[model samples]
Target chain A: MPSLDKTVAEPMIVFDGVEKRFGDNVVLSELSFTVAPGEHVCLIGPSGSGKTTILRLLMTLEKCDGGTISVAGQSLSHMTHNGRRVPADEKHVRDVRKRIGMVFQQFNLFPNMTVRGNLIEAPTRVLGMSKDEANARATELLDLVGLGDRIDSHPTQLSGGQQQRVAIARALAMRPDVLLLDEVTSALDPELVAGVLKLLRDIGSSTDITFLCVTHEMGFARDFSDRVMMFDGGRVIEDAAPEKLFTAPEHERTQAFLHAVVDR
Target chain B: MDNLGTFLSVLSQGLPFTIIATVGGILLTIVLSFVAGLALLSSSKTVRVISRIYVEGLRGTSEVVQLFWIFFALPVLVGFQIVPIWAGILVLGLNHGAYGAEIVRGAVQSVPRAQVEGAIALNLTPGQRMRRVVLPQAVVEMMPPFNNLFIQLLKSTSLLSFVSINEITRQAQQVLVPRFNPQAFEIFLLLLVMYLILSLVITAIMRTLERVAAARVGRRPSARSRRQATGAGVA
Candidate 1:
């Protein structure tokens, strides 16, 4: 595990007064947080608490309506243009987004490509890795995810657990510094969920990659995350280490939320 | 009209022209279909409007009228004349191309939204996403409707007769019917047979294409398999 030193290093991710909304529905308002390098932070809350929106903004899938988001000290929400704070252009957003990878709840593997094809496509086309190098990367990563035998299989042919495992490998193939998991196992069958979660825990433990995960799988959050931030109405209502937050959450809302989740 | 004489006459005088127009028109149609279809989905308002004008303007008007206007009037208006064959192709291409744009648009839209989000997460450019991800998936849906339009376009080549190009219908009316007067039914039967053969060839080609495209995306032709794949996929 990498050291979680808060001092003597620039943060890996910073969201300063970030605001996001759709039409009249305000999802997140004045949200601010910082994630340290190599720290696996989980965001947990009620279903509509803008947990997934946070990941979407970080991935640049949706632009923040206000404030700024920075990755490793580079602005993602805005770019410096002739000394003006301009909304980041496509080129700027793509450049920042290159360092980030996201896995969806749906496990959106490219149905058109095999497991190996999914793993190597972006590396070859976007990152310009050599074909042999990309194939080698796919092999190593598929083996890491315990999917080495299924490298040539199509996604639709696999069980949900296997497909999610492929998605995890696809994200990691990019070698992102930050991996965003938006309810990765929520779509899995009951028996399959544990296997995916176990694989994720193994990956989280072994890698130095910064993780900002959004999940309703509270047990996995407790076991896998160093820090868990309980959110309500887009604000971080409670933030603490998993041990303290899960067992002795101070806020009434956090206590109540945990109770509701644990009961369910 | 003697069936043999009609067949030989159309083959020598009009068959070449018909083939040329169909081949050239198909090429034009495919190009326009993709260009306008993608433009319809463009983020730019001006591009969308420009493409909409082309699609609607061509589709709303009659192909024969447009052919006449391009062949007879366009030269006077623009100070240049188009050959009869080129004029037929342009009109036929633009007209079917408009309908084809809708097929392309709907097919592209049918690709699941999550699939696109996945592509974006990998940091692909919009163009790359369409080419590498979206189109490959959408092409499976396009082949069927595109086959319909291609056969329709082939039959529509008979319209080239009116524009002074000696395609099948022109030879049948002015030459074959006049010479063989009482025996015209045989000539029409032969014409029908020829068209059926062409349509079947189109069906064969499209089926082969659909097979290749479906395999690339791992989509089997059976609807039951599609249902199961989709049901378990997103839900």
Candidate 2:
């Protein structure tokens, strides 16, 4: 496994005073966090506590109503224009977004595309890799995800676990610096969740990619994440090492949330 | 029997015009449908407004009225005459294309929002996302609706006779109404059978297309299973 301590001086992801709202409902209010390179950070919260929104914001799938987001030391919410910082343009967002990838709760694989096609699409289209190069990368990733035999099959043919693995491979194929897992295994059957979680664990241990994951599986959070942040009401209530956060939550809200999760 | 043979030959003579107009109009409809469908999704308000206008303008009016206006009234206004056959094709194409555009828009929109988010997460350009991810899935949804639109288009071609284009209906009225007035009933029955055959052929073709599209998405049932489910060879 690669050393997790060789991160650059700057953080890989930064959300400073981010605020997000959907109509009258506030999803994330003044939420802020920093993730170092090669870290595995897990976000755990009740439903609609804004955990998923954090990942979506980082992926640029959703925009923040206020505050700035920076990825790899570059402005994601705004771009420099004439020595002034203005809201980022589409091109700037696209350029900044190339460094990130996301796996969704639904797996969300392209049913029309073969597994190989799904894995190679972004690499070839966005990264401009040659077809041969993309194919080779896809094959390797499929093998890593234990879906090498299913490369030619469409996503609809795969089981939910297999589809989620393919979705993981598809995200990894882009060689993103930051990978967002938005409740990735939440939609999987109970028996199928372990395999996907184990695959993610292997990826986290074997690669240098930074993972920011939102998941309800407390066991996986304890096992896979270096840090677990307890969230409620669109704010991080407790941020601690997994052992500390899971075993001895300091805040009353964190204790109540953990008790609720563990009891259920 | 002799009268039946003559009626068949006369209707066959007009088959070329029906075939030409149906094929040309459908091809034009497909093109305009895609253009208008994509325009509805365009970022520019002008493009969206123009698409709305085209779809609504054609959809709101009567097909016969549009055909007559294009064939009869437009020539007087523009001082240039279009051949009746071409005019029929143009009107049918524009009219059906307007309806088909709604199908395209609805199918495209029906593609799950998560699929689009997955594409965006990969940092694909908007065009790449649509072409590579969204459209492939949306095309499957669009195919079934397109089949419905195509049959409607086929039936609409029968109205082209109003513009003096001698399609099957016109041919039946021209030959049977005057020459063999007493056998008008039989001639009309033959016309009905011809239209039925055309519709059946179209249904078969569209069914095959739908199967091929379903197979692409891995939704195709196995041949054995399909046969078992439908109880093939039961009769």
Collision pairs in model 1? B1-B183
TM-score of chain B of each: 0.91, 0.91
What does the lDDT read for residue A96 in candidate 1?
86
- What tens digits encode model 2's per-residue C-alpha lDDT throughout A43-96? 998888999989988888888999889988777888888989888899998888
Q: Which stretches in model 2 have alpha-carbon errors above 4 Å?
A: A1-7, B221-235
TM-scores of the candidates in the order shown: 0.92, 0.94
In terms of docking quality, how is candidate 1 classified?
A: medium
TM-score of chain A of each: 0.95, 0.96
Best by lDDT: 1
Worst 10 residues of 2 chain A by lDDT: A1-10
B1-235 per-residue lDDT for model 2 (tens digits): 5688899999998899888888898899999999999899899999999999999999999888998889878999999999888888899899989988888898889999988898898888999989888887787777656766777777888998777888998999976779988888899999989977877677677667768877887776345433332211100
Interface RMSD of each: 0.8, 0.9
